[model samples]
Target: MGTPTDEDDGVAVALRDAVRTLTLDSPHNRNALSSRLVTRLYEELDRAEADPGTRAVLLTHTGNTFCAGADLSEASARDAPTDAPLGLAGLLRTLVAFPKPVVARVTGHVRAGGTGLLAACDISVAGPGATFAFTEARIGVAPAVISMPVLPRTDPRAVARYYLTGERFDAREAARIGLVTCAADDPDEALAPVLDGLRRGSPQGLAASKQLVTREVLAAFDRDTDTLAELSARLFASDEAREGMTAFLERREPEWAVRQTPAR
Candidate 1:
C-alpha cells in the first residue's frame, strides 16, 4: 500500500475534503491492468474503506488513456495463463461492494476491461475527449469477466454491438447506453455537484443508498465470477487467441481479419 508521499507508484493516493482520489499513473502502458496495478488498487480500496473520513473514492487517471485494458504484453509473455480474470473479478467486486461511493472521472480512452472498471462505479463522468471500446473480441476473447459489472449497468443492445464488433464510441454514446452517468465538455465541472452531494450524505445513508442499486450487481458477481474467470482463462490459452494477441502486439492483422480465398 502506498501513502500519499509515494511518488513512483502506479497508483497515487491522496485524501482531500473527504474524497480519496486514486489516480492511475502508469501512462507508459496506458495504465493497463497489470498484476502490480491490480494489487495496488486492491490495497488502496482497502485503505479507503477503512478510513472513516473518506466519504467517496474518485478513480481517475493521469494520462491520455485512462486504461487500455489488460496488459497484453505481459499476457503474451506468460508461460501459461494464470487465473487473471479471477484477479479482475475480485477487483470489480471490491469496487461494486465498497461502502463509500465509487466515482469515475474519465477524460481519455478506455478499452476492454477498462470499461468494466467504469461500469462498476456508482457514478461516472466522461469528458468530450473520452472514447471507449470493448476490444476483447479483436484479441480472440470474449468480454466474459467484465460482463458481471457491465451487463447490469448498460443496455444489452449497445453492449452486444461493442462486445462483438470492438468498435470505438465517443463518450456521448457511452452515456446514452448507461455505461456512464453523463458526458460533459468539462468532466471536473460536472463532477463538482455530484461530489458535493456525496459529501453531504451521511456515511450510513450513502452506504445504504448504494446497496439499494448495487444489490443485483453484487448478486451477479456471486453467481458468475467463477464461471467467467474459468472461461476467460480457457480462451486466453487457445491458439487463436495467442495468434490474435501476437498480431496486436506486432501491429498487424490477425489471421481471422484476413480475407479468405474461395476454392473454385
Candidate 2:
C-alpha cells in the first residue's frame, strides 16, 4: 500500500491506508530545498492534516542525496532581492506543528537545511551508508533557521563541532548525537514496526499525541523563527557569503578557506 508509484514524481504524494507518504522527487538538485519545493511540501502537509485517513506521514526522498539544503542557486541569484529562505523556515514550522507522526526515510547523505528537516520529524531512520552534515558554515552562513528544530534534538557539543566545521558524519554518529533515531542497514525494515504502530492509531489520537509530544518544538519555532530567518537571509546576502557560495558552485575552495603556509 505505502509503496512508490508513478505519482512519485516531484514531491510525490501517496496514501497507504492511513499513512500519507510524501516523497521529495527533485533528484536533479538532490532535492534541494528550493522555495518551490518548500511550498509544495507545505501543501502536502496541509493535505495530510486535512485528510482524516492520514494517521501518519512518511517523508522520503527520491535520489542518492536526501536533500542538499537550500538551493544555493536561488540564494546566489539575489538579483530579485526576495525573502528567499523564509519559505523554508515556514515549511519547518509546518512540519514541527504537524498533527500526525512524521517519519523520515533517509536514503543517502543530508546537509545543512536537510538536517533540519530530519530533526523536525517524529522519527527518522537512516541507512548505514547515509551521511549527515551541517554545511551552512562552509558557505559563510550559520545554520540559523534550522537551528530551531535541529538544536533541540542534537547534543550541544556535537552541534558546536558540526555547526562550525561543516564536517560530514556517518549515520551511526548522527544516531549517537540524537540527530537520527537510529541507523540501520535496512531502513525500510527498521521503519516497518513504527509505521505499523502508527497505522493502528485513530486520527484524533495520533493528532493529539503528536501535538502533546511536539509542543516544545512548536514553541521553539514560535519564539525563535522570525529572528533566525532574518539572520539567515542577511548572512546569505553578505559579501563573504556570496564569495563562498560562488566558489562552491565553481568547484573551487572558497575565498575564506585559508591557504596552507610552508612549515617552519
Most accurate candidate by TM-score: 1
Candidate 1, 9-112: lDDT as tens digits: 59998888899999999988999999899999998999899999899999999889999999998877757448788999999999999999999999999999
Q: What is the TM-score of each candidate against the true structure?
A: 0.95, 0.94
lDDT of each: 0.92, 0.86
lDDT at 100, model 2: 81
- Output candidate 1 Cα RMSD: 3.0
lDDT of 2: 0.86
What tens digits encode model 2's per-residue C-alpha lDDT throughout 93-188? 888888788999997889989999999999999997789999888888999988888888889999999998899999999999999999999999
Per-candidate alpha-carbon RMSD to the true structure? 3.0, 1.8
Q: Which residue pairs come into collision in candidate 2?
A: none
Candidate topping lDDT: 1
Candidate 2 wrong stretches, greater than 4 Å: 1-9, 261-264
